[model samples]
Target: MKSALGKKKPLELEDNVCRRTNVFKLRGNVPNYLEESGSTAAFQPDGWGYKSHWGMAVNVYSTSITQETMSRHDIIAWVNDILALNYTKVEQLCSGAAYCQFMDMLFPGCISLKKVKFQAKLEHEYIHNFKLLQASFKRMNVDKVIPVEKLVKGRFQDNLDFIQWFKKFFDANYDGKEYDPVEARQGQDALPPPDPGEQIFNLPKKSHHANSPTAGAAKSSPASKPGSTPSRPSSAKKAAPSSSASKSDKDLETQVIQLSEQVHSLKLALEGVEKERDFYFGKLREIELLCQEHGGENNDLVNRLMEVLYASEEHVSSSLIKSMNSPSSRRSTDSPSVSDNFRFV
Candidate 1:
């Protein structure tokens, strides 16, 4: 056999600082490529080479080649089309539930979809959804940084930029699988009704005639269906709750009495304050009426009063202001400068 030792090709290894894994699995309905708004390079069959997504040598995965930019309209359309809803702005994504669904679309079963509250109306609830998204990101080991603090504040630029970055990441890894946004959410915001017992903690009644807490609870209790007789608890089972409820009701009544007394006192104080305000206002109004009766603004006394009125609220000396606004002062202010007649031409 011919000697193969010297004939062996020198071992050559390429230095790839930005190394990437050739094998990766992604499931998404969107095309697996990023492009500028109007350009469809990677999306076309000619551009779909081995390096690209769709075809066989065209290196479509070259990020440096495409100067992709997402406009507001394009981002909104992408979001609406993927989520199957109408979202006029990206700031609405503050709730974070939609982002949780995004993770689900990228990596199915990464999060419990039902836990996301689409109808969450509070800031804390929004934070909760974001926390869930963070946890999911941790589990998936995604390298992206999420600015939860800035994002939760719902700033337009912050959220828009984040969404744009996410759009690029999504396009690169998407496996071209069909995903149903509605079915993935399993009906958004399936929150249970508020318990009748919890309504007791609501803000105190603002009406003049406040009802007792027990009465309010009774009113809030769910009513029986039409023509259906309501069932009563047995005496054995009801005795404990009856005693406890009575004790609680007694405490509530005491609180109500104390609050009512405080409210009454506040109302009386307010009335006294109003009377004082009116008394001062009436005195000023009477002086104004007297000024009008004498000779309107031109009268000397009226002018002096007006001067005092126009001056700062601090006490002013009678001599500080002139008795009337002279025509000489008016002419000085209104006429052109004396230098106009003697310009250095």
Candidate 2:
């Protein structure tokens, strides 16, 4: 059994890895096998043909295999390879723990122990695996160093487009059984028809005299009937006086109410006007008192000035008259007659 299994080709393991990578791609998630670049190769015991710890062993043979030596280019190449794999096959190969472990190994310190513990709380933690992987990448600032868009090159965009298309297609095609018009009509038709005799019994019957001309004439001329005419008019005439009286009383009440309201409004307005007039009248009286006091003072000053002027004029007139009468007598006064005589006649 050991000899037969030992003869198994290395191509078989490569094929398995390829198939696994394809499965991971379908799930829109990163595969673990890509991170196996630095992992140790399977070491078989002497008696056993197959290696017990095949996943743990790192291959030292490959030149670009070491995790420490692996650069951004190497990581990008791994991502591209994963993206290129068949999506359905990759889904079959991927596991949450394996993917987590791969990311933890690839980025070294990016995924913390706390994050791993948080995963236990989730229902279907694998669904969140991509987000965790992106978080890990972001933590290391891997997007800045080697942009994810350049590496993936529209893979995420393509997936999103596919999802949108699928959703639209599903909604457009969806038809509920309850809402089908044909089914509803069929259900209505399936109900049994009602009995004609029962329908006739349910209908209202016409009276024998319904179509009679006399019955129609009687109904049409009800007001023209001898007994009905006098009673109707008498009752109507009696009701009219009472109705007219009631209407007249209502109108008078309404008019009285309106007049009262108008009177009340006018009284209020008049009171306001009177208050304003009183206020202004008080102010006018105060102004009149002030004018009277100032007028008295002015009159006293004018009278005093007039007395002084009159006294001065009288004293000057008296002195002039006295001088004229006394000096040179009539001779000095007659000397002024020369100037008077020289005046043009």
Candidate 3:
């Protein structure tokens, strides 16, 4: 464990700010520029990328959220769909692999994904992944403190709060690039399984087959015994993924992302249209109310405006003309400028 820890350059692990201006930039909110030249790459408040991370990534309603609603399920679904992680809850993301990958997605070729574990079985493994995440955060100037202890505990509320902020930051920084979680992790999702199931396939299939007997055991119900590894050859049970299947899955995931983006755009457009519709409806309603309250004094103008408002789209001008010439139409000398109705607006 000491040797493993030694391999990674230990973090400064303390804050001692003696800047030229004597200003201390707060955590995850300040620019920790190593080079005085001011060239930075992480989620800094001044950064064009992940600038929102310093502030409230908690309020995920902004942007597309990239979803129809930024509800808990929607947030989790977005994560699972994007990362191919079967995350039923936010606590599953406590390992911080997903966030590291997110940073990698935002700034390509940063985090060493090979060192990062997708299936962190042990607490130490989770810590290792989070350390990598912290390194990336530090490198990129992402101004947020990762509450490792709380997160590693896999508490729902803690993880949910962090992930909600993460989702917002991701949406803010993501530039519509297709990120393959499977490919990113070298086709090893290390999908967070239940405690018992976690032992079955924590490592790569080949490694598990050789190191553990769970694969060759071939027993359908292996939860009864995690240590029992039968010597039976289990080549059929754990075949390497075919290139074709992998490609198809990638294509499908790509399509899903594209469709989701399109759907988000459509939703935004629909909202704009609805707002405009309501605005016009409200204006017309207001005008109608005015006409109802004072039509006796301004019969001709009200009649004309009413005819136009009630006109059918199939033949707008014809409908207005018909209403104007109709025998039942009211006649009055008072003709106010059409602008009166819209002048207040």
What are the lDDT figures for the candidates, one per model? 0.57, 0.35, 0.59
Judge candidate 3 against the unseen true structure and give its global Cα lDDT, from 0 to 1.
0.59
Q: In candidate 3, which residue pairs clash? A: 28-143, 28-144, 29-143, 42-140, 213-229
lDDT (tens digit, per residue) of candidate 3 on 93-180: 7777788778787777767887777777665567667767766664565556677666776777887778867766676556587777
> What's the C-alpha lDDT at position 143 in model 2?
24
**What is the per-residue lDDT of model 2 for residues 158-196, given as tens digits with 9 covering 90 to 100?**
333322332232222222222332232223221111221
Query: By the TM-score metric, which is better: model 1 or model 2?
Result: 1
Better of 1 and 3 by lDDT: 3
lDDT score for candidate 2 against the true structure: 0.35
Ten contiguous residues minimizing lDDT sum, candidate 1: 50-59
lDDT at residue 37 of model 2 (Cα atoms):
31
> What's the lDDT for residue 136 in model 1?
67
Error of 2 at 262 (Å): 0.4
Going through the candidates in the order shown, the clash numbers are 7, 15, 5
Question: What is model 3's C-alpha RMSD?
Answer: 26.6
**Number of the top lDDT candidate:** 3
What's the best-to-worst order under TM-score?
1, 3, 2
Worst 10 residues of 3 by lDDT: 53-62
